[model samples]
Target: MNRTLLIIAMFCSASTFAQSPVINNAEIDGSGAQYQGNLGVNQAAGDLQQQANARAIAVGHGASATTQIRQRLRTVVDPRIDARSSIQGDSFSHGNGVLGVNQSAGASNQQANAVRISIGTQPQSIDDSVLRQQNVTLIINSDPTDSEPGYRQIATSDQAFTGSRGVIQLNQSAGVGNRTANTLSVRVTD
Candidate 1:
């Protein structure tokens, strides 16, 4: 009797897994408007609001090179203008929200010296009212480079002009090194 019950349960689980689930009241909508060339919001905030209601998920199991990638990318354009003109954006947000990336890895390796680079930026504008109550945040994490790499380098720069409500803010940082042997080498290549 126990063996019979186990077989019955296996059949039930297999049947349930084979069926596709349904979504109630499912639909998709999109619209656009254009005015003077530069002044229009080709993609409206309300449209993005609708899409953001859905949960987003990405999963990579095993070797990513051997697996499939599913993605959604937005391309916006004015229908009244030339057919070839359009703006494709990989990132967009309104008001404010958080963004993040998390990476974890297990390793067993040996290597020679290597060179690589990663770059990014975020530019924002807020009303004086909102700006007064908040401060912008910037973060950079170099992980293996931040810790293990002996030759560390960092640079920061700023420039601003005066005129108006009598307020100004500035911040700066820089790092430099001179030529050395084993630990940290700073060579001049000209």
Candidate 2:
């Protein structure tokens, strides 16, 4: 039988060249988002004050039928005040990271998209490859009145993102002649 059909057409053309690539009339899309925030306040101290004072004395004596004979003494003292407060050292911290990877395959009528977001302060230095999207935010504060108190605060943040897109199309009929090949790769890791 023609040598067993030529070994079954060489095992179906070697299994289609060890197949591992397929995309037919396709569309792909992706997205990513991130945010971070932190705040802190602390105070500790001690204080107090007080005061007092007072004194008086008088005496007189005269004749004329034992008319005048008198003596007087007076004294007074009182005053003290105190106020205290302590706030266990205050502190706060925040951190964030984002890696958005959008890989789009090839085919006819194909579309792909990706995004990452953070707003405020600073987000661990940023580098955008094709700029998918990224945003980061952070804020810290401390305040006290009445002759000044005390405070300590801190905040931190970090973020990352990556995106990739690839599209390929092959259509033939009108004249009967059209063939194509394409490949796209994207990566972001930490």
Candidate 3:
């Protein structure tokens, strides 16, 4: 008796995330006694997660099993911000003021790929092979010259404050890949 068995499986997963450009302009002016608290601006874009799994099994005489899994991810982003504050004239009392700006583009990406193959047959000869491939691409533009169109300039005028001030903060980021994981397993028995 002669028997032949063949099994082939292929799995492909692709994910692409693109974030649009961000532009912000802010201006504040005070002339009299003013109290401001908890003032903030935030922007974020392009976050993705993906997973893929494949399995193949063959059981017989002269059996062959093959499995392939591929995962790809791409991200692109740009962010821009501009802020200004001015306090003119006398007796401009400002107390306990907090101001902040946060910008994030193409951040936090995760991917997982898994493959399993199993083959069983009579006692003779066994051959097994496994292959895995991963590709990633990222592009980001966060800084530009003053003459370029993507650049933003803030006012450099002097600010005058008569009272106490709290805190001022600014944060910026682009193209940050957080975590990635891949797994593969193959088994053959006779």
Candidate 4:
């Protein structure tokens, strides 16, 4: 009986270790309590492109050709945050905090460019010139300021915690031919 119990325990422990751990894409806290700290988060990218092209041609007298080009680009930034109080507690006890959530997906992001060309003529003149240049600069300052806060500070603070909170959330997409979708939100429940 002792040997059998030992074998079973070993098997259980092995199985537990073999199971995969739970992983989440975003940060989340379940504890219902006030948080005090300074948060500086930065997410940036250089360049991104998504394109598709199709071409069909026929040179004979009675020729038929078909061409189709389809392109799709979708970006979803959905963050699920739940800070509800399970039992009636001090839900508005948040203190002075500095939070900065900067999400700069890409500088020169090109998406959903589809081109379809069909030519029946034999001879034609073609001239093409393409020049691309991109430059991006991002600066963020979270220093405490005793002076009056402007619209930028108020907007960022409103989305974060309550009380005297100085938060800065900047969502920027610089350079030419940039396409992006950004979403930032913070909720406090009582």
Each prediction's Cα lDDT score? 0.19, 0.21, 0.41, 0.32
Write the residue-wise lDDT of candidate 3 on 1-190 in tens digits. 1222222211121222445433233233343335476444443444443333334456666555556545566756333222222223432246465534333334333333334445656433333334344556464665655533233333322443456375433333333443343344445666
- For model 1, give the 10-residue run with minimal summed lDDT: 102-111
What TM-score, over all chains together, does every model reach?
0.15, 0.16, 0.34, 0.22
Ten consecutive residues with minimal summed lDDT in candidate 2? 47-56
lDDT of 1: 0.19
How many steric overlaps are in each model, in order? Answer: 0, 5, 0, 0
Task: Give the clashing residue pairs of candidate 2, or none.
Answer: 117-135, 118-135, 118-136, 119-136, 119-137
Candidates by lDDT, descending order: 3, 4, 2, 1
lDDT of 4 at 12: 85
lDDT string for model 4 (79-180, tens) is 221111111233213644443333333223332211122334343322221112232323233545543322111112232334435432333332323443
lDDT of candidate 4? Answer: 0.32
Candidate 3 or 1, higher lDDT: 3
So what's the TM-score on candidate 1?
0.15
Which residue segments of model 3 deviate by more than 4 Å? 1-48, 78-110, 122-131, 144-175
